[model samples]
Target: MSESAGQPASVALFGTSADPPTLGHRSLLEGLSRRYPLVRTWASDNPFKSHGAPLAMRAALLEAVVEGLESPNLRVDQSLSSPRALDTLERAARQWPEAELVFVVGSDLLPQIQRWYATDEILRRCRLAVVPRLGWPLDSLQIEQLNRRGGRVEVLPLQIPATASSAIRRHPDPQLVPPELWPVLLEQNLYGLRSCLASRPPLR
Candidate 1:
């Protein structure tokens, strides 16, 4: 978010519920790492959403997910709190003052940016990196409007299936989420399910 002429500008931030970090999330991180030198990822409880699994469980799963990936730029930041983009950006300012901040979001959240809490503050804080969602198209006109409102938006070159954590909670689909984390989900008995498939003991 630093506008100073000489400030370093290579860090990007992606925050999630970390409840069932999906396949699309993996794609987003992969694309982000290719462009940014450092990608900071964090997980928190979304107060707007329904009840979620324990943060510890979600954070552990997120750690495992990152471990399975090959992106060296990706860093799991489990401590980012308040679950607000503005809050996280402020935290970044205190921790890494020279690093420019970019908030990575899904296309579904693009148009809703201005309507979010402290929208004007968020617009002033950082640029946005938006990931595409299947069946949900982004509007160039809308992006233009956001730009006019003093927001910088960058779209990542990735199209991923739109499978949300809510959908996964209702129906766990192995293909919709990261394959490597499937067994971890199974071992945790998450999403209020006790399926025999998810009950098997973890492989030795």
Candidate 2:
């Protein structure tokens, strides 16, 4: 965990488009739990990207991951899900009125944060914590832009796996996500998982 200049934030808000909630998501939640007193996550509908599963199922998958972890500090709160991050932030503010909110995001989103709705207001309201992704390196220029826009950015020292939900959607590998999600994925036939299950060889 990277320390920011001021007092530690009271909560870490991690909103994801958890289409299938991969192991990477679980690992992130675990890491956030250890760092923040409270960690809130939700399966969001990204206006920029189309989803393979319904928001309900996606949120359920996230719930499964949170359940498996059994960490008191972490939870999946679907009510916070929103297409616009600013709306989510506002809702969270009302929910945890006295808590200092840290808006958590992946390093891949660093460049795109500037274009989000009410980006300046979001930055003003909460500190930004960017979790490093395997392929996406943090850009100084993007960081400078965020700072110029009144953002307090911190790149957390956490090793998130290389696994990506997009890649899992492209190739539904059971090993890529947590086993807790397998039954739901198979039963629901999500992300063309049935074909992948059939193609796998029997266990030795």
Candidate 3:
């Protein structure tokens, strides 16, 4: 979105399912927050995947990861809303009326960004900071098309050599998440473990 001539933009958003908050996300938040004034990390719902952990716990995990890093610019919101990016931008606008919103996302999402609800309106609502995922690097031609169509998207260079949350769910690892909060994930039994623990009781 085009910023007003004299207005200042301060708030940026990072929305994620954060099933268990991956190490790559940790890196992205650190790098992005350094550039933006406020980077709000949201634990949003995803219609495609059945979330293993409850919204409250997912948010807690995100907060724990951020807190472990001691990043002052990052904030976590657990509130449930429409899975669409457009809706999140609208909600952010209503809450931070004067704040210029920028949506931070992974590169894998760019190819399908246009398919999102009210894609045009979403572009008009906020700027985009796209992170280059391992397998989903930015396509030059695709970017060109977006720019030509009035979408303001910037490709970020930060890369995290970690796998997706699903992998962590199937095989929990401290390296994939904040070292300090490893125990929490293990003790709580999130993601893939949920199926195993469904008929069992919590660990003592």
Candidate 4:
């Protein structure tokens, strides 16, 4: 969508499944908002993948996570499906012709990005802002390969990396989520961990 009149254009695209967006996901988006004048966060609706919640439900959960924090320049687009990253970037480019596009991803997902569909094209269209995650080696050979192609990638140095969706899902305490976001999580029914968090009990 073209920026109306004098409005500034979006500069980045944050893409994820966002099965049920967690606090860490919100923090990452907030960090990007600080650096980019216009950032559009989006989630996927992949028919092939088994999502924790239905596509509509996932979208609503993300909407709740970002509610009241919306800005004229910051937008959340839920209309798109699981288009190839390159295709999504192209659409974003068409929508905001003057803006540069950056794709935001976590470090854990960065190393395997080469395996993504049309990854090289995606890289050519937008630079990557890789957020670091705990326990994932930042110095792996795969990272070396990415660095070799580093001209298109920038690693974001996040101050705190301890919080993760997996950790939150695995936490024995059902009360681990902060009060402000508890309703959002519970509303989405994402706290169930029977399959992924085998050792942890399901939230009551």
Model 4 lDDT per residue over 36-130, tens place = 88888777865455666666766666666666455565668864445577778877777766766878877778656887787667777777877
Model 4 TM-score is 0.76
Best by TM-score: 2
C-alpha lDDT values of all predictions:
0.75, 0.88, 0.75, 0.65
TM-score of each: 0.84, 0.92, 0.83, 0.76
Against the hidden true structure, what lDDT does model 2 obtain? 0.88
Where does the lowest 10-residue lDDT sum fall in candidate 1?
A: 195-204
The Cα RMSD of model 1 versus the native structure comes to: 3.7
Candidate 4 stretches greater than 4 Å from native: 1-10, 46-49, 68-72, 80-83, 140-144, 147-151, 167-181, 184-190, 193-204
Clashing pairs in 2: none
Clashes of 4: 1
Better of 2 and 3 by TM-score: 2
Off by over 4 Å in 3: 1-8, 192-204
Residue 190 CA displacement from its true place in model 4, Å: 4.6
State which candidate has the highest lDDT: 2
**CA error at residue 8 for candidate 1, angstroms:** 5.7
